[model samples]
Target: MFGDVMGMMGKIKETQQKIEETKQRLDTVLIDEQSNDGLLKVTLTANRTIKNVSVDDSLLEDKEQLEDYLVLVLNKAIEKATAVSEAELSAVAKDGMPNIPGLDMFS
Candidate 1:
């Protein structure tokens, strides 16, 4: 019926709006992570863009150690950022994705 088609069209429009809102929400999300001893730190966006990094002055004296710690700290920050992105995206998907049989399994 025409009424049923109209209702489905409205739902699609609403879902599109929700998707845009979720993208905006993701843009504002920032995740900050630091090394165990606080010698290195990094700030990353939920979209995996590195925003900032801070390293203790002492670490700068040793190039080898600094490289090691840089890798460690960067990896930690990336992991945290990925987790945040996944959680936020999953929440948005659960809210806006169309309902279909067996679709929950993929989620």
Candidate 2:
């Protein structure tokens, strides 16, 4: 019985290690997504930090349209970044990771 317990404990440790490694790997992996129109765009890090933005010549032709384009692109960028992040993190949760509350920690 003691030997069996030790083996089980070892497996748990290994799993925890895998989760940590996976998180680290995810932190290193980066993905950039943008909308069809370049009027506005954002660059995000693997950890979801806005890195940069771009504007298009056509959108700037109209001040009002430029503002709308900026808002639209921001929303689209956020949506895309979140989707990609969630998909990647799903692997972490599926493997039995703990949830970080308030982060919308999803599976």
Candidate 3:
């Protein structure tokens, strides 16, 4: 029983390391989103860090419209990034988890 506990502890440590590595890798995963009218675009990392934002000059003429475009496009980019981050991290964690009976958290 102690041996099993030690093995499980080792597995948990490995999973933590993998999770950290996955987070570093996620920083390079980019997600791009654009406005419906193509006047605004955004790029973000899977870590949800904004990389860039491009806006057409036409959007500069209207403050409210530009704000709306920014909100919509940025939200879309964040959502996509969040999904990618979650999927990658979860896959790593689930793969590294020990097969403990009755603790089917991933399922």
Candidate 4:
């Protein structure tokens, strides 16, 4: 069964390569999201860290409204990022991982 052993080895190596590539991709991927009002936008890493946020100058006309809008927009942006990360991870994991999107690929 030497041929079977070699075939298994090759399959293992291919799976290992996909795992490494997905690990690298997930580590630094970021998603950008914008508010429907165009007043705020944010960038979030795949791991759910907010990298940056921007607000339009016009929103500052009302402080309380601006604050409320900021909170809503930030939450939306994070949600968008979470969706993006899940989609991407799903695509990558389709080749190997069968459990869930955020399962530990590197491990």
Model number with the top TM-score = 3
- Output the better candidate (2/3) by lDDT: 3
Alpha-carbon shift of residue 8 in model 4 (angstroms) = 8.7
- Deviation of model 4 at 17, angstroms: 7.3
**For model 2, what is the C-alpha lDDT against the true structure?**
0.64
TM-score of each: 0.77, 0.55, 0.97, 0.56
For residues 1-107, write the lDDT of model 2, one tens digit per residue.
68776775676576677767766675665555555754466776556667777777776789998787767766766676667666766665555533334545443
Off by over 4 Å in 2: 1-37, 97-107
Compared with the true structure, what per-residue lDDT tens digits does model 3 show for residues 1-107? 99999999999999999999999999999999999889999999999999999999999999999999999899999999999999999999899999999999986
Which candidate wins on lDDT?
A: 3
In candidate 1, stretches whose alpha carbon ends up further than 4 angstroms from where it belongs are 1-13, 105-107
lDDT of each residue in 15-90, candidate 1, tens digit only:
7787677767766788888888998888888777889899999999999999998898888878887888778767
- RMSD (CA, Å), each prediction: 2.4, 6.2, 0.7, 6.2
Each prediction's whole-model lDDT (CA): 0.80, 0.64, 0.95, 0.72
Q: lDDT by residue for model 4 over 59-103, one digit each (tens)?
A: 778899788877887787778767877776566545653333476
